[model samples]
Target: MDFDALRRHPDLEAPGLAAADAADRLILDESASALAEVAGPPGSVVVIDDAYGALALGAMDAGARGVRVHQDPVTGERALAENAERLGLAVDERPAALPLGAGLLAGARVVLMRLPRSLDRLDEVAGLIATHASTDVRVFAGGRLKHMSLAMNDVLGRWFERVDVTHARQKSRVLVASGPRQGPASDWPRSARDDELGIEVVAHGGVFAGTGVDIGTRFLLGVLGDAVPDAATAVDLACGSGVVAAWLARERPRLVVRASDRSAAAAASAPLTAVANGVGERVEVTRADGLEHLPDASERLVVLNPPFHSDAAVHTGIATHLFAEAARVLAPGGELWCVWNSHLRYRPLLERIVGPTRQVARNPKFTVTASARRAASPLS
Candidate 1:
């Protein structure tokens, strides 16, 4: 398989951005033995967080069939499909992208994964595999050496009886684990009360800022009351854990609130957050690629705390993409309220992409801005 030929298109592609990396190659190489061991139906092999189609496609290229896959980012999901088509893999040879649930884990004899930065995220994946997968399942989790930690072995230890570290290769390593442990029922979708904000924060392991508000989100909340006071409907884009959507519904009794995110964890956590805050009926949660599911010129206002990174690499292109999406979704004269790192100086980009941008609030670390949709714009 030509891993180097894969491209991260439909994602932010730059000179340094890659569709596959050393960690991916190492994972494929390390999991080859287990791949040959997979038997029976197509679902016997499972892949998680495949950056593009490297792990899944590579496994398929190695002759493993019916690979079930799950990627948290919609961009990665699209990239995988595009790469598969580009590689000329047959329809039956392509991997099935599934959500992080029983269907993705059930009856799996082998699992390949890219180690997530969040230990909680890893814990969740490990727990699901332990509970739902075959007792003899062999797990191969790999990542760059810089991103690997001893704590991951501890997390896997909780779910599996043994975890063995593989020798380093090109700054990448893999953790092999077998012997699933039966434990107490899963304790996911954790929740905690935020007394200051008067709401409950619900989170699954993979969701950002699990069970708490980040400083940027906290800053956004402080000024949220003044965001488009007359608008009847609003959207919370990149809505992690749905803190903003839940807050909007509680503050504005008449406002229709929608929370959308690409992460399965965030999608699962948001509605729970709404229910915990007693706003479940008012907040609608959707797992989607940034407002792609939204109709053009359909929203009066949108709130965003756009992510600054594409995976581990810090890139401003993600925020720019969100700003453009916000502009497309907002009706003429509608507004986009956003919070970002002050140093990024997104005001100029916001002005160009959305409309006339104005500073809403600012501190040493963060800047909050409002941009209105132009009655006519170049991008629109």
Candidate 2:
């Protein structure tokens, strides 16, 4: 299979960003024998966190039938579907998309996973497989050596009795784990109270910043009180765990706040946070790509603490995409309140993409800006 033929559309696509990498190829090659053994059942092969359709499609191409797949980000999910269509993979042969749950792993013979960066996420996933997958199932978890660590092996040790590391190929390696250890049920989607912010935060392992507040979000929360006071409805674009949405709804009793994120974990955690904070009635959460679900000029206020990284790479394209979405979603006189790293200096881009922009607040590390939407502004 030509792995490089895959495209990362619906995701930020740049020359530097690839839909498939050496890691994906290395994983497929390392697991080729195991995949070939998965002949009888439809879901005998399971692929987790495939950045695109690489692992799932590759498995199907390698004669693995009924491949089940789960991807954290909605863009990755969409990209996989589109890639399958582009590659002319028959509907019956394409991988079945599933959520990260027992059903996804039940009766699985071979599991291929792209190792997640977060140890918490890895723990949760490993726990799920150990608890649900077949007793004799083998897991092939692979990633670049630069991103892999001894800590990952330790995490896997908790669930699997044996873990064998494969030799590095093009800076990528696979960890083959078997002998599932009987263990306690997973305790994921943890919750904690932030006394300083007077809010309860709930999070799944895949959520950014986990259950505690990050420094950047803390800074943004401080200035949220002044964002478009008269707007009856507000949006929390790229909302992670619904902190901004919950805070807005709690502070303004009558305001209707909608929170949207691309991450499945964030979408699942946000509503729980809202409910815990006693703002569930007014807070709406959606799992979507940017603000695509929203109509043009339909919102008066939007708050964002945009992410700067795409996977492990430090890319500003994500932040810029969110800014353009905020501009499109905001009403003519609406405002976009955003907090970003001080060094990025997004004021000029905000001015060009949204409208008149001014610095609202600034700390040594973070800068908060307010950009009023212009009736007509070009979206870059």
Candidate 3:
């Protein structure tokens, strides 16, 4: 696929999420070289964790047919499909949308994976490949050296018999591994009880901080109802792992809550978290970009810990975008309670986007604020 042939989905809601990056180019180039050197049987080429279409389509360009792929983020998955159609190459996008399962690697001889930031997530990916891939499968994983770590080697070492590190190129490195080994059962979706919340948290590999609560969400949970008093329905916007959703459902049995995020993994994890906490049927979980799936002025309260980064870049537009979503969804006199990094100083922006905003709580690193929508004009 020509680099020019690819594009991030025009409708992707993220502000700073890139369509493709240097590491993507590096992985494809390195994988091509590795295959050329080894001259191995090539069928069922798979790309894992590709943020967009670069790896899979790049493989397609290199004469690999039936390239199966998996992207953990829903947005990334959509982008790959949209880019594939944009290329107009007899586009049957079924391969691009394959999940992480036998169908994805029934006979995978070669795999290209973009390294994830979390060691646990990497362990999950590597372990799945070792368990499902054909014996001759060669996995080429690459990442920027700055974000890559020694722990990654150890994680891959657990599943692959041998892990070979390639020389760095453009500050990016590829890990070439073969010889899948059978190992102990994977401990995916690990669960633990949070005594403070009096509920269990079952987190999949992609969940943040594993089973432990993030400090920002923890702070936000401490003051949930205060932000939108008397509101019957509440939303956990950008609900990562659904800690807030579970907590709210348990705290207010009458509360109707929804947890929504852009990541398929996170969206899947939220329901698991609810089931672990015995609130499965009570809380609704949906994978969505902001409040696109919800109607205007339908939500009475929205609790958010808006992510500052769009992919890897530190961008405030992500938070601003979420603020705008809250402004659109919240009912008249409804409120949006948000927790964010103090340094970001989201107060003024919140006032402009969601209406009169005030600091509800503060600490050394994080600030919690509540912005009430004007009763006159929900849009305004």
Each candidate: what lDDT? Answer: 0.91, 0.91, 0.82
> Cα RMSD to native, each candidate?
1.6, 1.7, 2.6
lDDT of 2 by residue, 1-380 (tens): 98878999988898788888889999999999988878666788999999988999998888888889999999999999989999997877678888899999999989999999999899999999999999999999999999999999999999999999999999999999999999788898899999999999999887888998889889998988888998999999988888889989999999999899999989999999999999999999999999999999999999999999877778878988999999999989899999999999889999989999989899999999999998863762
Q: How displaced is residue 75 in candidate 2, in Å?
A: 0.5
Worst 10 residues of 1 by lDDT: 33-42
* Candidate 2 TM-score over all chains jointly: 0.97
Give the Å error, residue 304, model 1: 0.6
Please provide, for model 3 over 1-380, each residue's C-alpha lDDT reduced to its tens digit, 9 standing for 90 to 100: 57756666633445445677778888888788654533344456888988778888888777776677888777788888888777775765334577676778777878899888888888888888888888888899998888899999999999999999988888899898899998796778788888876767777776676788888888878877575667788899998788999988888888888889987778878899998888888889988878888998888899999887655667777788789999999988888999998999899999998999888999899999999887764673
Please list all clashing residue pairs in model 1, or write none if there are none: none
Report the Cα lDDT for residue 252, model 3: 82
Q: What is the lDDT of residue 126 in candidate 1?
A: 94
Highest TM-score against the true fold, candidate: 2
User: If candidate 1 were superposed on the true structure by all CA atoms, what would the RMSD be?
Assistant: 1.6
Error of 2 at 97 (Å): 1.3
Model 3: residues >4 Å from true position, as ranges? 10-18, 33-43, 376-380
Lowest summed-lDDT stretch of 10 residues in model 2? 371-380
